[model samples]
Target: MSMYCNQCEQTAKGIACTTHGVCGKDPEVSALQDLLVHAVMGLSLYAVEGRKKGITDPEVDRFTVKAIFTTLTNVDFDPARFQNYINEAVAMRDKLKERVGVSFDHNSANFQPASDVAGLTEQGKQVSLDSDKETDADIQSMQQILLYGVKGVAAYADHAAILNQTDEKVYAFIQEAMAALTRNDLEANDWLGLILKCGEMNFRAMELLDAGNTGTYGHPTPTAVPLGHKKGKAIVVSGHDLKDLEELLKQTEGKGIYVYTHGEMLPTHGYPELKKYSHFYGHYGTAWQNQQKEFANFPGAILMTTNCIQKPQESYADNIFTTGLVGWPGVHHVDGHDYGPVIEKALAMPGFPSDEDNGTVNVGFARNAVIGVAPKVIEAVKGGAIKHFFLVGGCDGAKPGRNYYADLVEQAPKDTVILTLACGKFRFFDKDLGDIGGIPRLLDVGQCNDAYSAIQIALALANAFDCDVNELPLTLILSWYEQKAVAILLTLLHLGIKNIFIGPSLPAFITPNVLNVLVENYNLRPISTPEKDLEMILG
Candidate 1:
């Protein structure tokens, strides 16, 4: 119930209905989801033991990630599907136990009858909030931190899995953190240490994903993407998968179909290998929150490769396809790195007319390619060609005040360059801000996890100037929606990075006292109106 659920950001205050979740998930389903998480934790522990014994297997890593992702917000909205995940996790845990010479106690199995929905609901109601009575606020904070940290790890693991990258250490840390969350004796500092460790592990997860992507495809390079529609059929690749887009691009090459990136996928245009494709078009709409309206009249099929999948409207339901961890009840799912079904659907859809035209979108400027221009960038800074650097990025949410991001971007000074990443760029990504000194003022680094790139660029700039990163004229204006952003934010904080502007609203899960510590120490401020915030930042 919302009253009890500290897990969700959107939990209802005082009472999340004992019978159902605010997100439409019933209480029985929520319990099952918890059980699934518990099972995954057990499996992760088994895998950790396996690795300690030098018994490595890819299935262990795969199952660990798969279980955590299944628990993501709105990913497994259907209770029936979530039950399947639970069963799979239990089975995987058993398999791992057997492999590692450990025996799982079958006596702990808590299975409910499929036909007894009402009975299951009653049982869910009887479920105690705590099986162990260690509810101190400090302990609660630590548990919450680790739980949220694992959620963020699951997100990064999902992204890496899409690129076929799996790291045992990353997976092990997730399991270890989850297990720690289940422990009652761990002190506050222990939890804090684990929370920081979670951030450190997430850094590795992001690095693994980055390596997987750039290694499989190629380092991203600057390229102009087409924003307008072309003649014939087209498929819009949304979410955050370059591999899927690349596969679809290859499949649709010369087939009279155009492929455009949407949301986080917009950065794919920067990849040299992916950009080499002639059929790959430019980005379409803004962020994930705008998808419902943007896809209303889209004359092409849409493929979602990861998160930020909103409930599809009927207008575009027939044309929307999902892959990897992204799933919507009735929407078609193309799993296992497969884009075959997606490609076929795109070909079948009635594409845009040859005579119809929209516009063009320019993307690219990832770290490797950006670093290639480092000497020039250094020269520009020396000559006063570039003044302030604004890292305007993070996640997109359904909150109303998010428009502040667009306003802030619009109000950014002419001499400043904006380095953005993740879905947050949707705020001002579609705007034509023009370029300065042969480089676009707005540069998309990559996904949220690619905050690493933003850090790299900032550190590089600081190194060039022989000063600490905080001393550089770089400001981090971030908007967060989910746990992944939480991990990234912690990573920034852990590095002693300060002067951050965070909004559209603070996380509901963060207590006032915890937030105060962040604000007092890190100088993190909520975003205000663009005019005022711009004045404050520039001054």
Candidate 2:
């Protein structure tokens, strides 16, 4: 049971198969997950060693992103298909080793099985457990945290690369961290330091993505995307990559296929270059978690530019197109900026009639754009038009308790404003929460990693209000499902931001003592009923 199920956030008490994982991952699915991570560690080691000998290649970054992305929640749930990714990683490792003239003895006694005796000593498997050593659960937990953090970093790096923002140092750190996870000699402190380092590197990764996005698409500014539909045949592009969406808008220009933003793509509507597209329609869905239901009856083809892809049902499968690192078993992948396949598929789908109404959504409140509104926002606060700022954001999942977010947003005082990032906002994004003054109640702030932007906005507000961030009329209510949240949380800690409310449950991987440390130092609390949590924040 242990052999196949060794991913981060896996069941420590036993294998995770409680209806489904807390993150929606199943058991058989988890084992193939372990294999993929193991294979990536091998590939990263080979790539790092190869670079020492004057070898520089882009494929290393590509392989690193693919390997790490496969381990993300809800990205790949099929064990058999995951093993294929592992095989591909092994093949990449072998090819890199051959080019670098290096050989690794897999049978060496140094290799330590990640699981215990009962777990590793399966009936017919050749991998053996180390007889003299027992892996410490704390150390393992720390290592997993670092690895998952790096995975999040890799995802951001991939996005930046798509926008022509490549950082060699970032890719090198990815290789370094992946290779470190496989070494059994490292101590707990060493792993802890690496975990912190992962946070620091993620900061760099997010900066790169910010530059890539703003530099290419122009800074996102305040723009009201029309939620009402207009007449046209259109295509809706979702997910995080503005570059791909820009290219698609360009390709489909004047072709009668209007483009609309969905989910994280809603932020693209704020960019000067992207918003200039007259055919660019408004947002379609709330968040990635709602894709299956939201896309069920959409009138146009959908293009997923990055993660947060739900397993598509047969009804809309043919209409779903993917680009960049996102892929599904049967979906058509539009590689590079080619987008030929996506264009062709959109044309082939039963698009909306010429007279059909294309809806509109309001977006664009990124750092620069929001900072531009600082004077007015501060004036409103002084004028008592807006009372508080609520950063109700993070990753979204299928857990039953997750609906608390939607309910919490619904119940927030009318005087409060919501600043959201990542995929979590899908819950109440479509709700007519009304506005405080002229500002809409809910503001979409791009991808999950864009939590950085929310941080900047909070700090700016505090500076304007002449107080520390905590002293300002601001609160952070976060929902996490994956490592990007881990990295972002660490950054908040590094900055001494405290009193965060986190839920639907504490991470299963965080030991009680670690939870205590976080709670005592940061005043972190698990989310409870929306009525109660809202009262705590609003009162």
- Each prediction's whole-model lDDT (CA): 0.73, 0.72
RMSD of 1: 3.4
lDDT of 1 at 481: 68
Candidate 1: worst-modelled 10 consecutive residues by lDDT: 105-114
The TM-score of predicted model 2 comes to 0.84
lDDT of 2 by residue, 156-254 (tens): 777777777788888888888988866789986687677767777777778888888788878777777766555666688887777888889889888
Q: Write the per-residue lDDT of candidate 1 for residues 1-539, one digit (tens) a residue.
A: 42144454444552233445544455666665666666666666677678789877677677667777766665555556665666676677777678889643322222332344444333443332333354775466556656766787878877787777877778778877865554557776687778778878877778777888888878877776666767778788877767777778877888878887777887778887887888876677777767889988778888887666777899888888888666767888886657777667777878876654566656667888788888988888889988888899988766568788888888888888888888887777778877788878888788786777777788888888899988988889988766778778777777778989988776655556666767898888888888888788778
Model 1 Cα shift for residue 536 (angstroms) = 3.9
**Which stretches in model 1 have alpha-carbon errors above 4 Å?**
1-31, 49-56, 98-134, 337-340
